[model samples]
Target chain A: MSELELQNKKVAALASTETIDGEIATLNLGPTHPATHGIFQNILQVDGERILSAEQTVGYIHRAFEKLAERRPYNQITPITDRLNYCSSPINNMGWHMTVEKLIGAEMPKRVDYMRVIVMELARIADHLVCNSVIGVDTGALTGFTYMFQEREKIYDIYEEICGARLTTNVGRIGGFDRDFNKEFITKLRAFLKEFPKKFDEFGALLERNRIFMDRTIGAGPITAERALSYSFAGPNLRAAGVDYDVRVMKPYSSYQDFDFTIPVGNDGDTYDRFMVRQQEIRESLKIITQALENMPEGDYHADIPSFYLPPKEEVYSSMEALIYHFKIVMGETPIPAGEVYHSVEGGNGELGYYLVSDGGRTPYRLHFRRPCFIYYQAYPEMITGSLLSDAILTMSSMNVIAGELDA
Target chain B: MSEFANTIKDSLLEKFTKTSYELDGYGEHNFFMSQDEIHPAIEFLKNNGFIYLTDITGSHYPEKEGAEFQVVYHIHNLSENLRIRLKVDLSEKDVHVPSMTDLFAGANWMERETFDFFGIIFEGHPNLTRILNVDDMDYHPMKKEYALEDETRTDKDDTFFGR
Candidate 1:
């Protein structure tokens, strides 16, 4: 080749490099991608096939939930929380209701608390099934994802039997559940308890030992305990880093302290650790559910607060006092004393907290949700910094970021 | 009665003499630090075992005569298994506070969210863009002054999801 031609080619290459330098190539991953579980968008800055930085642009499904809760009555807020993390609606429902109940200083019966535990644990199992299966699917294992989805469908069917709605279930009331779990619902749940453990074992065997699956997740998105904690990561994400801090154990709400279970911790804070922690958690949750059902006390499902909880249908039609109470509760006449309460539940993803401020009115003054995904999403760029683009997707699935919770 | 709350309170109060910090009975510890002491206060918290920076949320209290906004920082310690609240007061005009993103990477989006909702800008945030709200949206929805009714009607036309 001529020397002049060689010089020209070198100059051309330098110009192209300069154009791309310090300008992180922006790539819109989704608002509609299978990898992103929900409608989440990540404006990725890529260098070749490696992701240099990722700016998670959520709010595609932002429901203005906090703002909506402020306008609605305390009981009306349950439906709103249902949409926050739709996959784990029961946990969100219980968390929000518990916060309100705490603010009001309302006490529930032992039976009610046990029921809450059963429902919440069931929700946790369902949530983990989705998270683990999605991680497997992202890592090129689709069969396990489908199998888990079928299992999750059974759980959803149970939810429908208890509450009219499945995904956005406004299940629990302020003090306790809206109604008692009938014989059929209990029967189905008992049968699920019998079947879930075996299926769970099958799920673990399928993906936990797979050579291809292990390669994709073993050391992928490794985060130190210090880094995980520093990033305000919670739930399984923090536990996967070997932190034995489960809110259910540390600060038990809804009679979680009554149950005997172990908090699973992973030594290496990687995708594999996260996946394993979640799988183990499913087992623990199943145990909790079984224990709750076995030890459940028999009593009224809801507290005897006529103003806060709805009166019986028979009483509503029969008496003027019941009618007035019903009207007052529906129109949000029952006073909510001026106070603020911050309640945190160990949600499927991590610590799902609801910080509610009440001005003694029917509606909430300000409701700030401390969403786990929002916190974990911050460590995304750090987790996927030097890894391949595929690893980034896997890391996100393991993170279990629900766009609803993040945006809310 | 937990050692975690007491340890955090003692450590923070000892570190910053002027800052008023208190411990709630339900395991939540609160530290009321000045804007100037926020960086140093957070630095101390990070080093002294408060490793997790869970969330940084802003609240506007226009009714409280002089105080316009209050910013709350929720931090957790993994080893001790404790959660604490660190707060600072900011006026509407000069709503600047030292960014904790340098210490805790998790504070990045949270600080942006505070900025988006209550318009309390983090001075050194790497990307201080609107998170929940759309870009070019002027009003801070969380602020008391921003009318929710006006936005609710307009938001219907702009976005289909009502997020």
Candidate 2:
């Protein structure tokens, strides 16, 4: 046969053969879809309803936070961390500041430690509520979401009362809180503690025993404990797989050792396990917050290091030393020592670790954030391999895959 | 101390000279091996119970002349409850290393991320496309020389001859 005839025959055979067996279909889940709570897109190769392969395409909401932090001063990085995990901004803020503090060897007072624990626990509760509520919403239950969101609003109210901001709360400073928690903030937190349990019980009862919810969650996206640990899954997801590792209980940063709480664990290692683990964690967080509030100390909130933290307004006006310190800190002229430190905090989702390298300049030499969601999201393709598309949504929601943290 | 990390380290030291392996700052059983020994070291680690690869990351240090890229691999042993970190330094000119995804399937995205951020090339990575950035982007933003241009800047029309 001639070369041209051979080429024509080969093209005909290639066109006749199927590229993918049993028909491969592509589905775009969303950069703006309801399934993805935030801006995230997932491209799925579906064989019928089951996902043959899934690829999570993030960076739609990417603000290049790490690059931005490298350019900004050490103190200015807190607000960027605040946006990394918007639902738990205080956790991110405290985690980032604590990493910088560790690099500088900043010693914080006991009162400041207690305050940090309290705020962090509050952020934990707020973060878990959103995760659980969204899981319920994804499973086709809306009432529980509304109830949990109302409780989340109460936590936000406490945050607003403590700091001027609600969501992006730059409430924490380098060595301690930006300011002391006032009587109103304490009173409202006490009220939240008293009222949250009843509402929590309602949320739990609403979803825990519901037959359809249980069917959708149990055994859906079940990852083995070995696989979970291999993926570096931490916080509730790791605990959900029956790994009794909690950064707070294990590492105990920022006086987390002073508070008493249990690390909840789940054995099934499925979407239901993750959901149950987070639900119980909300209760444990409440206990920790209550203890922190009861043992709240009376002393300086911010550290005495006026060069790093802003001095009080009274001190700024009255003392020339404080005024100079204020001017230097505000203008980002403070010299941070050269060193590196890795500080990991047990964020609501998992281990939110910050590894900061400083060249003794005002800005960080390099800042690497080990975001929990990013680690968890890495296992998404495997997690949803044989599950339905709806199971993928449940898995994402159960994993508490925050786009802010994942994309960052 | 876990026997798994020690066993792997001893085995790696046997194949490569002691000068080629240096302990990390933590004094944990972690070590930074020379880049040439990475594939064999990973193979040894996998064959001897370090089955789980936890995380892979790339750190860029521009000051170092040729040794600018530091690739980190975190591995865990389920039976031993131990974690070990293995690091290898790669240069900007040739940032190629053997892919570990064949041993640990979870290393797929982690290696892709290192390649995406540090421009490191994994010899056997299955689908080695840009995982985080657009395919058209020319530079790796995580590198030291990457400039931060203002995204909002636009060119004006004042260059027209009529104006």
Candidate 3:
């Protein structure tokens, strides 16, 4: 037998033994277990309740988004982005849209820019809501999760008012929103903005200072700032490690420079630090949303570019130039600049970046996503290596490794 | 390029003479180096304050002569608010590059995912294996020659949605 096989057999024999001699027990934590919160398996070597080692196996739902983007037209690829980090699909959609805009040099009107900020910030809030409450849930506080998730549904309603879908909201077009935000959207957004904080505060009060929640998270799975940086950590996790690097602040895109918000940092890069950073971030996202809505500019929602945006159908019937442009758009014949560009946004998870290489074709030659979850997940096993088995779930939940994002 | 970005470019040029590179728009440089120079270059840059390995991914150029795969690395210096792009070329027969996992433990799975998709092995990766794809998948799906959908998936007939 091979060494691996021999070792496995020996382990099996030891596991079956009635008279145990302190050999570490093996546990397949998930590919389907509830604790993981996603489709991923962790082979945990444990001694009673303390974890000895954790070997993670992701990609249970590996949809080749990068490869698929190569085949699909630039516009068609927007929907493909929707599947990555599905909790915050709108943010990915906007990020992809902006990346293309950067490639094409499409300048947007101020209104279109701020409108995007509102939608993107809402998506950020929704993502953090799921992550923070799910962290609470992982620590056996299910009631707080139920409370916070209801607020997420309200955010979903706001998304529905703007886009026709909620979950995988292919909400906007390349240059800007497919259509202008209506009065209904503004009303619903105002209601959500007005109402969400109360529920958020109530949810926070439930677990923020709860002794059990604090103990389960505060020092569990701690990582130093230097270690977190070496691991290329970003977003809240890096922020929790006391690094205040936010993409919105560092590399401001879509007029984020006009808005003011603080990047919350935590003392220790532990589960509690991750939790607190996200909680504070939700409040900051709300602030950005309010500012964007209040100072909402009055202009065209979509950029006035004939190349990216198709001419109106009425004009297409009357004008030859319009007809040709419309035809080109329908046939996916838009010309792409031949160059390489890397654009990043402060994704709900971290610095979500898209590195695009174009060959002057309608589609990208190569596209790679700097998926925050994927990068941060590498540090997961190391972080959970010596912690109690129960804390492993908290660390995983705090990392917010969405399977769709992870596998993509 | 900004003066700060140019300073970084000049410093690298002064240190590693005759290294191939391209100027990226964001005031950063994309140094096209050889596989052998990747480790030394990263080590030098790490000492110079580019502490974070922001991302590691592969870009395939099947049509380009001599270079079939390009392993791209984005290294960041948070203190200076500067980022640099490093690309190393690999031909079809030999697609090996030194792993960055030893330098940055966060590179472990990113390198594995790249290997899973592109079959470009990182020589010193501690446990390099297929990530984000089933191990049983024989072919690397992200190669330029590979089609996006499986040819055997017959239930869907030219429909965007499987429905």
- TM-score-sorted candidate list, best first: 3, 1, 2
Worst 10 residues of 3 chain B by lDDT: B154-163
- Misplaced by over 4 Å in model 2 are A1-24, B1-30, B39-55, B73-86, B103-105, B150-163
Clashing pairs in 1: A62-B163, A336-A360
Per-prediction TM-score, chain B alone = 0.85, 0.81, 0.86
State the lDDT at A353 in candidate 3: 92
**Model 1 / residue A186 / CA error / Å:** 1.3
**lDDT of candidate model 1 versus the reference:** 0.82
lDDT of 3 by residue, B1-163 (tens): 6766677777777777646778755445789888888888899888878898889999888887779998999998878878889998899889999998778878888898889889999998777888777778898888877766686887877543310
lDDT of 3 by residue, A1-408 (tens): 532354466545534553235667799998899777889899988767766566788878877788888877788888988998999999999999999999888899999999999999999999999999999888888998888888899889889988889999999898888788989999999998899899899998988888988988999888899989878888999999999999999889999999999989998999999999999999999999999999999889999988889777799989999999888876678777788888899888999999999988767889999999888887886688666788888888998888888888
Query: A1-408 in candidate 1: lDDT tens per residue?
Result: 532254346545534564445444678899898667788788876766666556677777776777777677787888888878888999999999889888887888989999999989889999999999988888878888888898999898899888977888889788787778988898889889888788878888999988988987998998998778777789999999988877888778988889999999998899999999999999999888889988989898988777688888899999999999888888788876777678889998888898887778677878899898888887877688656788888888898888888888
The clash number for model 1 is 2
lDDT digits (tens) for residues B93-148 of candidate 1 = 78899888788777888888888888898888877889888998997888766555
> What are the root-mean-square deviations of the candidates from the true structure over C-alphas?
6.6, 7.2, 4.6
lDDT of 2 by residue, A180-199 (tens): 89889988998999988998
User: How far does residue B140 in candidate 3 sit from its true spot (Å)?
Assistant: 2.1
Ranking by DockQ: 3, 1, 2
- Please give the CA lDDT of all the candidate structures: 0.82, 0.79, 0.86
